[model samples]
Target: MTLDPNTLLAILAMAAATVLTRVSGLVLIHFVTIGANQKRALEAIPPAVLMAVIAPTALVTGPAETLAALATALAAMRLPLLAAVATGVLVVAVGRAVIRV
Candidate 1:
């Protein structure tokens, strides 16, 4: 498969935009003074972003996904991050296979 000139340009443009946003974040961060609240907000941002992406899908899909998310959250509190993720994935896969939902 080959990309034509327009498609190639579009891909490059998107990549440049993505890089700009990331680099700008780093640059802008240097100007900001992070106090306790700001630090907490920064830490919360990732999980909030993750939940924003996942919650809609899970809610719309069914109970299996919801349960899997709950399991992931609980496991994440204690297990290593990767293990927690694996546990969530495994639970969802098994639940889907057995429950047929």
Candidate 2:
């Protein structure tokens, strides 16, 4: 199947829309005044957003994937953030290799 010019344009437009939605808050923050209550809410936003992203993955993951994610999250909570991410990636990679063998 061939991708026509119109299809390519449509795909680009959809990608742009998705990116704009994701980054709109950062863009808007530069122009907006954040009050005390808003600031508190903003502080919670990262973990809330993370939970929203992670919860679905955790729920949908197979037993091995869930275990790997849990190990990564626990390590991240106790150690440096980057280390946690690395540990999680390692766990998932190792798990996948083991499953394949």
Which candidate leads the pack in lDDT?
1
Q: Model 2: clashing residue pairs?
A: none
Q: Which residue ranges in model 1 land beyond 4 Å of their true spot?
A: 1-16, 97-101
The whole-model C-alpha lDDT of candidate 1 against the native structure comes to: 0.89
Candidate 2 C-alpha lDDT tens digits along 1-101:
88899999999999999999879977887999989999999899998898799878885877657777888879977899889888988888888877763
Predicted structure 2: lDDT: 0.85
**Model 1 TM-score, 2 decimals:** 0.70
Error of 2 at 79 (Å): 1.5
TM values, all candidates: 0.70, 0.53
- Which regions of candidate 2 deviate over 4 angstroms? 1-41, 99-101
Cα lDDT tens digits, model 1, 1-101, are 87799999999999999999999999998998889998998899999999899889987887778878989988999999999999999988887877864
